[model samples]
Target chain A: MKKYKGYLIDLDGTMYKGTEKIEAASDFVKALAEKQIPYLFVTNNSSRTPEQVAEKLTEFDIPTTKDHIFTTSQATANFISGKKSNASVYVIGEEGIRDSIVEKGLQINDMNPEFVVIGIDREITYEKLSIACLAVRQGATFISTNGDIAIPTERGLLPGNGALTSVITVSTGVQPIFIGKPESIIMEQALKVVGTSLEDTLMVGDNYDTDIMAGMNTGLDTLLVHTGVTTVEMLQSIERKPTYTVGSLEEWIEKM
Target chain B: MKKYKGYLIDLDGTMYKGTEKIEAASDFVKALAEKQIPYLFVTNNSSRTPEQVAEKLTEFDIPTTKDHIFTTSQATANFISGKKSNASVYVIGEEGIRDSIVEKGLQINDMNPEFVVIGIDREITYEKLSIACLAVRQGATFISTNGDIAIPTERGLLPGNGALTSVITVSTGVQPIFIGKPESIIMEQALKVVGTSLEDTLMVGDNYDTDIMAGMNTGLDTLLVHTGVTTVEMLQSIERKPTYTVGSLEEWIEKM
Candidate 1:
């Protein structure tokens, strides 16, 4: 087995399942911590800030800090800042995405913006979608944090940012640049934040579509754990196989 | 020119354009009345009730009554009732859709609904979308009032019901049964209301994509007026042409 110098991990499925703790997750992270291997939690969730995500991981007894988190919100802000410094933007999202854009010095303008960014917004209104459509129609660059269609919640699968983003896309006839998993944009940014070369980094997650495809998109090795979402049966149906597959993260600790 | 016994006219672009009256609309409708031809105003707009739409057309000096107005909302309610009388429906729309459903004696149910209907809603919220998604995922039949992507307003083209419907469609991975123009559903229902045979009725409108296409879809002869969306230059590009093309309704008054 090839030894990875650093690791990029997923949040909801890999580290924990919703609010419940995964038994192998704590041990797996502790192994990485003891070995002094840098690992960052790369999450597509743009609703919550790094601090909030770190706190949740900490509650689960996983060694985490604000620096250890890399959200799609941060990736989106980084992407926009790279394009134009202090660009005017029309945003439709929660505090996480809003704060990230503002922290990067992007101006939030409802009218005549240079860019339109959409993230997961539970407090979303028709007015927000209307503004986004109008802005996109006016030739604003459209961007979305991620393209996850349904978000798994205790209540059931709810509409994700990708679903909400479709309103503006359909209305204005403009496709948005998605900056999350399965896209190289978020993966490349996560690699830089994790301070790891693409070849030396291992992307670990339970989702075959998002996490594994994201690693493949960014030219990194992927480890699929069967703790959530994709099972062994699901993997057999897929043509492209992950670099490694395990029943739990604990199975990979010795190799790491 | 073939003499049509009845007419199904469009409202927005044919009758009036956003509170502004079309000059040729009044004389044309008066001619229809004078000739004693049975006519009904067919509209894709599901946000307003028949009475409200009739009131607006009356204000525009067109001979219109609630009985002479057929809206997509009414078509949707009728569609649902035809499937199952008093069927439980989960709706995400404005007063027009809600009232139409209730008037048809359909029960409004958020939890465990038999059908999920979407229409244009200025007051749409995330919770409404969430409920619709959940209901659709739970096997409720999804229905959209119209597939119009954008609504032209004084400000600009805003997100229409189709755009809003995409949120639920994309999230739930379920396609909705669209009940408006370009689909034969609304036209078939409007034909029943207008008391006209398909061969004897002329579908008249300014928009080729909606009104003319609706006519074509339902096997009705179409007259495309160059007053709104589809222009002379735009019509030249289309392979399929309307049965008749006129500069204004005034030109057709003589034919009536």
Candidate 2:
């Protein structure tokens, strides 16, 4: 616990799932406040903007400023902006994708887009799919925010934007340049927000495949939380293991 | 038409769709018969076996034998068999996938598989996904039957097993070696079947993106059919034009 200075935390499965927030998530927030240690809420879910995520976190009684949030959406936009400063893009996604692209000062139009940006388009129509496919086949760059296939819902799992991306992939047979978490782009942003040396920072989350994998890929100490998506049973059965395993952030705070 | 020996046709858009066979499909077959033109039904649709496809074609009263049919599943199995000879595979697909893999004299079990062979798992599950991802990341070769994300349905086009393939991709960053039509891998198999030269082979279909693009990529003559998934409106709007466009395969026979 003494080795960790700043925490790079995950949202969604780690903190909350839909309307129901995690039990010890609030305690983790309080621990951060009491310790006065820097931490940033980072997520691979590109469905929401940083401001949107902050609002959700604040609504859950976890104090979150806009500055404390970073998303894959932000990383993707930054990456695209650097590559093509003013290229046109045809988007097949939601407000998050459009806003991120626009923030990077990229243009989004119906025709002659230099790239067909496929993000998480939950409201995907056949018309939109056809348009996105057409633009990509004409030699436009294809970029996606994240590659999550399905999101767990109250009733069941629903297909996410990754499904929409596959539509274009089938047409073009080209993979998108994914610039989200674990891709080194968002990890850089997280490192900046946490303001801790990479060696001293810790990423605490539930999903080992995404959260722990991203931290490991970015050279950060990772803590595996086992209450959310990846349950204790699932973790114990797995062959690949994590650095540090904790029941909840509250337990970690007690140890600290 | 004069430059070709006989056409190696594709199914779906090239010949028929569902219960509503293309208007000129039967007539086109008759023309081929009259001219003693040898043609093989090559399809990337891994859902149905060659025999199943042949049966469906016969339902339309079009003369098709099991011997005259070749499928991507068959090609994929042949590829894997030739490489490993008798390696074990963890099969996560349907009858077509199992039949093909078994036909190649390959051993399949639940143990440590040499490869995790992913075909069209129409009824895809989270357990299968987790297993496949884990197996592939653990150094098992991840081979995809084809890369078609969606197949046509009465409701609309539904995302296929190829959509699921992206999960393994985002997890491992390992591109799948797809053995299906439009890819040179399957095209080579179809060519080998007919003993036909690439110049003489015509890849005919309704979809310009996959079928036509595959033809274009492999230097095979292509004919875009109007009666399938792609409408004339959609075709006219896109810049990736097909080599030749036809109202129907029956009408295209007139050219020959």
Candidate 3:
């Protein structure tokens, strides 16, 4: 399309799931590569790193690197860095989240930190929770990667970092500055990275809440796929319908 | 206890699952029954009626009746009735949604409806969406039950009626009068039904976005159950922590 030069795509549900790649997804990427089209696999789930996501894509035979991936974690980190260039922080999270916070050259400490950056920490303990609440209540600007309370999986929906954010919110009565999907924060970053105009580019996602809304909110076209969290029936029933519906990434490429 | 004399509790995900009862959820009602507690079952899920929810509860061995139930459909109907007295409504919904529209003593027709009452209609048609959008754009007061974008199920998360409202919102830039949980619309009715003082009454549900927030928005003490849409981790991590946390309704009895 003459109107668009690049695309901003979502991972987890939009691309390969685990080691199993969706049919035509690889071929579509190959086509993009052959056509010299640029795309970034962005995700709101901040628990993983872009490197990790890229690795997963590589395993599925989709050639990728960290440069082609963007995450809510990254955006949050960038936002934090921009807002607080010299702030010390207490990180309630894992290596990925910790790295995101520390990557900005900001200090990470448990003792009287300037901010409490709450990310997805699987090993989160009561002490960490208490410390996070304390930090925020003490005026530390609490920020989170995304508000996805639960993540959908093949098994079922699992409580994501949104669950933790909820607890911290209740204790502090302060909502974290969210920097992920369906929010203007991450979309701005994606738009910058791809250098794609919103009108021409499309947001391909399986979730209506995050993906579709993100695109629609940013004035981009939206493509809904049934292979992820939401079904076509679900989309049809809703008052807000996406711009286009596809069965999978393969069908999406066919249309493209 | 000193202030409120009754209660109005939402049913879907709060009272029962697809066909199962929430833990100790019945005991709370039974305790109310023993103490001659006045409570009503209010729900935003228009998929069924008060009769169905009551029957499902009875099947689980918790006796309930139509008199003790109020649906958003019912609430919206009452709201419309109180406001317009008698006006024709362009109803975009199911049997429950339709019946509620009529309950307001309003005539239902697509010809020249003065207002548009939007609800979660499973068999949604493109024609309906267009009509509602047109009607709202034409200066009709648009009303919605809730803004819940997704509904969780055994299968997966489906686009809830809230998504419908979003579509209309984006198109018209007009927000509807939301009358469901977390909005303080129906929760007021629930309070009236239970005859419980706002100071002593407690709300327990599994969803943080609706059930718990509904209580938080109101002055009622809230207990977040971990059985349905929300989990233990979510309860622990939120910034808007509930008054109390329990793994299940059964665990709630232990608190008492």
For this target, which candidate reaches the highest DockQ against the unseen true structure? 1
Q: Of the pair 1 and 2, which is ahead by lDDT?
A: 1
- Candidate 1 per-residue lDDT over residues B1-256, each given as its tens digit: 7899999999888888887989999999999998999999988888888899888989988888899999999999999999999999999888889999999999999989999999998989999999999999999999999999999999899998999999999999999999999899999999999997999999999998999999999999999999899999999999999999999999988787
Q: For candidate 3, lDDT tens digit of each residue in A1-256?
A: 3335677888767776644677657776776777777888878867777788788888777768898888887787788788878688888766677777777788888878877877766565545666676677678888888777554445334345665565566545677888788888899888888877777677878889999888888888887888777887787689978888888667656455
Q: What C-alpha lDDT, on a 0 to 100 scale, does residue B164 get in candidate 1?
A: 95
Native contacts present in each candidate (fraction): 0.87, 0.07, 0.00
In order, what DockQ does each candidate have? 0.91, 0.08, 0.02
Cα lDDT of model 2 by residue, B130-206, tens digit: 56656665678888888777666564455555765665665456788888766878877777897778877777777
**Model 1 stretches with alpha carbons more than 4 Å out:** none
- TM-score head-to-head 2 vs 3, winner: 2
Which tens-of-lDDT digit does each residue in A94-202 have in candidate 2?
7777888898898887686887777765555556765666667667788887766666665344555565466567645778877665566678777986799988888
Ranking by TM-score: 1, 2, 3
Task: Look at candidate 3 and tell me the lDDT of residue A45.
Answer: 66
Output DockQ, candidate 3: 0.02
Q: Output the lDDT of residue B8, model 3.
A: 53
Pairs that collide, model 1: none
For model 2, what is the C-alpha lDDT against the true structure? 0.76
Interface RMSD for candidates 1 onward, in order: 0.6, 7.0, 15.9
